[model samples]
Target: APFRMSFAASAKHVRVLENAGLVRRKVHGRSHVIRLNPAPLAAADKWLRYYERFWRERLDTLEALIRAEDKAATRKRSRK
Candidate 1:
């Protein structure tokens, strides 16, 4: 399905995307063609993956610490 928007709103959104290096616009007479530039998106994906891995590792360490503490608490309660 084709997307629909007001010309002014569309132009504003296109300008933002163009500035971000995510889209390119080519004008031919009265017509304009917009194309996706994938390089910027690929770079963004790579950066996100790096941080995702970093957070995953930190969360795993936190889970392990919480489990260990819970086990110690259980043992202490049993002995009391």
Candidate 2:
């Protein structure tokens, strides 16, 4: 069939996905149904979220410094 993968290839991919904890499958009469399990993905997301707050605080400090410099430059220009 055109634009369709063979069942063997699809099954291999499904197995790989299952091993990665990204998917689960059930065999039906002639075809298999696949479902995604987000637990692993969620754990990764949570890990990244923990770092996001830390980076945000650092970026906020940088922004404050930039603004302070901008204000100082404006003050100096006014004195010219």
Candidate 3:
């Protein structure tokens, strides 16, 4: 493998994510099967969607302001 992570290190992070309700792990003999629990993910996506819209509108307003400033500058330059 090109990476240098030990199994212990991997398992530690898995435990954190599992505790956060992001993943589910099943132990079958020596094999540990990990899967995503999408409920938490869906909740996060729904929460973030509001901010996404908010920021998009904010950025759009910012862009409009910049464009208006550029137009004003252009008009001033043309008058010179």
Candidate 4:
């Protein structure tokens, strides 16, 4: 917010954010006031957490399988 950018680029970025439902812009005379809308961002966070848990469980299972296979290979070599 402290930094400066071109008006055209700033408007384009604002438009993209508006389209994504992350912000709401209201025009007061010649000035545009932008407000943050948290609902969409919260929903996206929830979606990401759900998939994070899913991948964690999947990777745990894969790790267990790999460990078991390594132990089996070690035993086979020790018996030779």
Question: Which regions of candidate 1 fall more than 4 Å away from where they truly are?
Answer: 1-4
Question: Estimated TM-score per prediction?
Answer: 0.92, 0.65, 0.75, 0.91
Give the candidates in order of TM-score, highest first: 1, 4, 3, 2
- Whole-model lDDT per candidate: 0.97, 0.93, 0.95, 0.97
User: What is the lDDT, from 0 to 100, of the residue 68 in candidate 2?
Assistant: 100
**Predicted candidate 1: what Cα RMSD to the true structure?**
1.9
Report backbone clashes per prediction: 0, 0, 0, 0
Give candidate 4 regions above 4 Å deviation.
Answer: 1-4
Task: Give the Cα error of residue 62 in candidate 3, in Å.
Answer: 1.0
Q: Compared with the true structure, what per-residue lDDT tens digits does model 1 show for residues 20-60?
A: 99999999999999999999999999999999999999999
Q: Give the lowest summed-lDDT range of ten residues in model 3.
A: 1-10
Best by TM-score: 1
> How does residue 36 of candidate 3 score in lDDT?
95
TM-score of 1: 0.92
Candidate 4 residue-wise lDDT, 5-80, digit = tens: 8888899999999999999999999999999999999999999999999999999999999999999999999999
Error of 3 at 24 (Å): 1.9
> What TM-score does candidate 3 reach?
0.75
Tell me which residue pairs clash in candidate 4: none
